[model samples]
Target: MYLEKLAEGKTEIGESGLPPRPPENFDMTKFDRGRKFIQDHVICHVLAMFISLVCGMSVVNLLEPLIFTNNSDTPNKAYRRYISTFMHVTKWYYGNIWEENNKAQTSILTVRNMHNKVRKDMTAHEAKIKNSESVDIDSLNHERIASCPMAMKDVRLSQYDMSLVQTGFLGIVVMYPRFVGIDCTEAELDDFVYFWYGVGYMLGITDKNNICKEGFHITRDICKEIEQQILIPSLENPPSQFYPMAKAFIDGGNIAHKNKLNSVESVLAIGYHGMNVKLPKLSFMDYCRYLFLRGFVIVIYYCPPVKKLFNKIIRHFFWDSSVLEKKMN
Candidate 1:
């Protein structure tokens, strides 16, 4: 029925009949003129891209001084600055490309959390073994506790601490004042700090046991011996130097006690658990481009002469060129 209605309006036309004409006032020239206008201003598209790049860098350059000033009264201001700077830099650099980076961050946190758990469990098992048997494992006198299974687990958990040391070293190297530059904004600087810390956390670099060899080989027997000999003495009068780092180590050890891995399979299980986690891998080329543009903005901002020169050049090239004609004498 629908097809029949459509067919009813159809008419057979003779070749001699005048073809249907477009509206009398319709001007094809208008469409052509519009196309020509766009073709003539192709440089505008390129200029827009340049402007965006410059703006993004400018934001980064402006962030550091604004956030990390000497008067900034926030506690742990340096740490906070690192976190904030990382987020801002990442957002600016990646913007719409943040999903993968976020996923990677989640995975790293998961691994860290699990690593903490295994350490705790191991600590408890070591305590029970030492208290029940009184085997006096410390008297055996081996520099490395390779034979003790609990000690081996402790050693393995120590890998996380080693990871943290590696990350901290890398952070110090990459985030140096000379390396990232003084012109970067507080936000950008914070971003730089956060990026490395986040990467370290994800890579299992912040684990405590792995940082020191003696700490790594801690077993049920060894810990008991240490508590009686070293820790008790320290409690009476803690060393002034290395106190903070030592405290951090003790705290990390406590966390590890809850996360013991008894068997080889358990060890493998913890390692493999976060394997499915994903991370964003931003292109190095894009990051380099971002840095270059940021540097360019900083140069313009810091040097008034360069800014004036840029303005003059832009005026001559674009504004002057866009004028229909020169002023008459």
Candidate 2:
């Protein structure tokens, strides 16, 4: 009966015994590109960019809260000191990241264990402080981290400040990509988000404060709430006066561009391009370029043998032999 209907021109296939054709002008190149994308190791390149963003953009937020604090107060002094130590942190990051799958100077498990231990110590210490009711909280940790800044100074670090630093990585890498940044598919973004949330758990982020578990939109909304709820300086509660921690990022970025022959620019550009995101401070032209590149990056995945070549470069730079691996248990 189906064949008879088709023979009588009662079916879309007509008498040809085949499905109807698409319009002649329908570009086969679209389908070809789509097929090529599926065949190519697109996920590998997306992940490479993800790691690259981690290494590169993580520095950008090192000086936040500077706008709200001064040098004398603990928050001001503490955070500036934190940024000053960022170079050392980068060394630890490189070690943790580049040593292939081997145990390294700063493996995830190693730092995670340390973070957990520190959290345990802080809880006990807090109980002691509360019970004593005699010691000033400001005097804890030798007045380094001090109370306030949304984080208390614990055994070693400020819990609130460290929480911010920890979540900053997840925010830039996962949340921004959902709208303003690169073209990560939902699956790739979710996997990356989930991985960091695991790290957050390992690092002792409390259920109350861990922001990375929420999906991207909710996380961003949380960010806006934080910005609003930041306690602005009142006459009674002035910002702690202090020297600037690092130079303003723009000043430092420009100076580095000048002195370093744009090694700084090159790294920053990876975040800029890899995410298809330009800072809002940049011009409309830059956003247009980002939009153009969002589409263009698809071509990158489809290039002949490029995924293999890109993966080789990524391994050479970030996954090769490392001295740090010697310390692994």
Candidate 3:
């Protein structure tokens, strides 16, 4: 049936399984460019730094399955998992982030399908372990240690937690527009949210979590509820097992500095929401350093001279940044 519909020239499929007509005069060519050469050039650093230092690291909190006792003391595993994820997402995201055309849309779908496969495999593994005729603790421990089993041991991520991740993306859509210089228009925001809403569905969330209808306000309310109800309680009394994973993220050689920045930012972000999480402690001076890096990143990304120079650099050795961006899509 799906293949047959494609034979009929249907390009748009909505959640309701109906095809929506394309908007009139929507220029497919310009959307394919992602950002003009200069725009993609300027925002690269902003997007990268945001993912590396803040949003990337905070995803650990969303790994609610780590709260389970059977999966204690596996920060090394979590570190391995999240760091790999960070690298994949950063490269994939910035590589194709600016395009509004269909060609690049499959990237998210591919990632989502990968996520679904992993979830199904893990859930099956957990079920096998639980229904086993006997237990093998040592063997299980070895596998868990070797493979980073914090979130995979005897359970899967809860449906509610998965739902919360949808809200998290919506939060980004809401807040990104408020960036001082970036003109994230309503149409842009809607595209961003719509993309993630598909992601949410693939991740096993329900329509109730799809607050794109209620606007950012209600979307944020769901985010707040996730924090107050699940996030805060888990963090304040965080499981001992998850700390090593957090440590690996914070101390991992490749991304330690960014991890430290993430840790501190997590503290501030949580507090800003009138909530608290007992994040890994850092000294006052450490706090200053991360804050400074965050601010400095924004400054450099917005500086036109820097952007122009970087654009030249990319065109010099690599392909044109704009060409690469579109090609990635």
Task: Give me the candidate number with maximum TM-score.
Answer: 3
Candidate 1: Cα lDDT at 245: 25
Residue pairs clashing in model 3 are 34-98, 73-241, 75-244, 75-245
Better of 2 and 3 by lDDT: 3
TM-score of each: 0.22, 0.40, 0.55
Q: After superposition, how far is residue 170 of candidate 2 from its true place, in Å?
A: 1.7
Q: Candidate 3: where is the Cα deviation over 4 Å?
A: 1-61, 64-106, 137-159, 170-191, 198-206, 211-213, 253-281, 297-329
Which tens-of-lDDT digit does each residue in 264-318 have in candidate 3? 3443343333233344455776667545644644664467576566545644323
State the local distance difference test value for candidate 2. 0.38
Model 1, which residues run further than 4 Å from truth?
1-106, 134-170, 174-187, 196-329
Ranking 1 against 3 by lDDT, winner: 3
Once fitted onto the true fold, the runs of candidate 2 whose alpha carbons sit more than 4 angstroms away are 1-106, 113-163, 178-181, 214-217, 223-244, 248-258, 261-314, 323-329
lDDT tens per residue, model 1, 85-195: 333222222221113455333434444464455445544545555565556554332212222222423222344233322322222212222221233343333333343
Pairs clashing within candidate 2: 70-240, 70-241, 70-242, 71-241, 71-242, 72-241, 151-160, 182-275
User: Which structure among the candidates has the greatest lDDT?
Assistant: 3
- lDDT tens per residue, model 2, 222-263: 533432232111111322321222223323433534642212
Task: Report the Cα lDDT for residue 264, model 1.
Answer: 20
lDDT of each: 0.31, 0.38, 0.42
